[model samples]
Target: MKKFILIVVFSFILAGIFTFINQPQAETVNRPSDKETSNLFESLQNELYEIYDIGAFKTASNPNYTINEIIIPINGSQEYYDSVKDEVESLVKNIIKTTSFKNYSVIVEKNKLDQFFNEKAKDEMDLRYEITKTVHDSLYEAYQNQIGDIGITDSAQQLIIEVNTFFNGQESNDFFKEMENKLNIIFQEKLSSNLLVKESSITIHIYNKYGERIN
Candidate 1:
């Protein structure tokens, strides 16, 4: 059992973008300096923030954070929920600023049904689809876990107004909202034109420096 646990732990560590066991002790985080790191930060921030509606960002108090954190029974934990939402937005912005979609970009080509099989009569389509889903799931999970650690659950939206106000002022949030709306259209159009697939929603959650519930 111990060996099994150790192997599982090691596997996750090797697979993850950042190690949960090895983060800094406090907030004043050190920024990454390499070109790749810088580009990722900038792209992720730009892509994420510029894609949502103001209402979407306004406050998703009852947001779905199931992908990252465990949902507790107590629901009215406004501070907790609000904090989680705020952190998520903040991280979404930060991730937009940092990570590049090229890091996880996928090109899905819609081929004719005939292309899926070979002359040998082997069912290659089934195998390939499973592999694709598995890869997508893993990437989504890692993305979830990376930002999930700092999200505060059971919080409310007022927290967002507070933080955004403090950081860029309430009025700036309005401008961000406009940018978010335009971005939503642009990203959707871009996805439709390029990937030719429809993306329903792109949600995110953030965590503050403490790795605890911010609210």
Candidate 2:
């Protein structure tokens, strides 16, 4: 009887050991450190700048390891930004998917610079668009469709006119200055009826057929 009891006890002990050994271990999650998260965000910022030529920054995360918001500074016109905003957001999403913190909710948006501008410059934007359209149509007609493209960059504080002409070697500082003067005349004529053109700074860039900024 003693021998049988000892064998039974030994069998129970062996079974218990086996059961403990076969039980699944709890999963270990490797959460990123605060420094690591900051580094990741910095890397993302650099990549965005390199790819899109836009300087974007991150706001403080809600939690240390989770990125929740990204701000894209609007350095161009509303029209220009609207044209590329979707593509830029898509690129950011794709990049985030490749990162370890993909599970975090990330929201990308234009900074308050644009929001404030849009709110305050609605009339200005309409007027500017009209002026640019008029200028573009006139130039296209005068150049016999030789005007390759006319792009505007409105940073809410200044206007930059980027003109590309198919006329090779025709782009010079003198030509650019002449174009600027013409633009100023039109702007003044249009803006004189309403606002004083609070943002009076206008920049003009002329490009040759080869897409080189000659002026």
Candidate 3:
């Protein structure tokens, strides 16, 4: 009985040791210290700013010697971002290739300053709607004034301005094309002269009764 108890105890001890030896070891993630992360981010920031017109590096994360996330705060309108997006993308790609990092990504996020610009854009668009209405009304009036001399009659409710260049003895396609071209010039000049509407944002369309564009 004593020998059997000893054998049982010895077997339990051996099993425990074997189990400990076979267990998976916990891998240590060597995340960079806060100071080290800040320094590396600052260095990268200096290099980036030298070539690009952009804001500072808001935050960075480098865990286990791998640059995980490099966040950059952008403060500009959509148009401004569009102009710089390609350059920023190229810069990030170059950095990812040259830097010794296993995994990383750059984020260019819009900040408070950009939000302000976005609000401003919204305001401009609201005003633009009103300006467009003014342009349409003014163009309709101008079309009415010129249509009589040009020998055409058009409905007031309709936006189409039909010119009777087709009836003015020169029935060739050239005459109609020339008349349309001249009308376009006149309308463009009138649109440009308007104080309420932006000439760049507005376009005048001249169409015949057959739903075809004259100009």
Candidate achieving the largest TM-score? 2
Candidate 1 TM-score over all chains jointly: 0.17
TM-score of 2: 0.37
Tell me, by lDDT, which candidate is best: 2
TM-score of candidate 3 against the unseen true structure: 0.34
Off by over 4 Å in 2: 1-125, 170-173, 191-197
Q: Per-residue lDDT of 123-206 in model 1, one digit per residue for the tens?
A: 434433333353334334433432221111222221111111112222344544543454345335433332112312332222
Which runs in model 3 stand beyond 4 Å of their true positions? 1-29, 60-67, 96-102, 117-215
Per-residue error (Å), model 2, residue 8: 98
Using TM-score as the measure, name the better of candidate 2 and candidate 3: 2
Each candidate's TM vs. the true structure? 0.17, 0.37, 0.34
Query: In each prediction, how many residue pairs overlap at the backbone (N, C-alpha, C within less than 3 A)?
Result: 30, 0, 0
Q: Where does the lowest 10-residue lDDT sum fall in candidate 2?
A: 191-200
User: What C-alpha lDDT values do all the predictions have?
Assistant: 0.34, 0.66, 0.55
lDDT tens string, model 2, 1-215?
99999999999999999999999974333465778678777877776766664645654445443344545554455676677777777766676676655554545555566567667788767766665676677676657766776777777667677878886875566866776676667666654453424455777777778988776
Candidate 1's C-alpha runs over 4 A off are 1-171, 194-199, 204-215
Which is superior by lDDT, 1 or 3? 3
Model 3 lDDT per residue over 140-190, tens place: 564544332122222432233343211334246675566556556655665
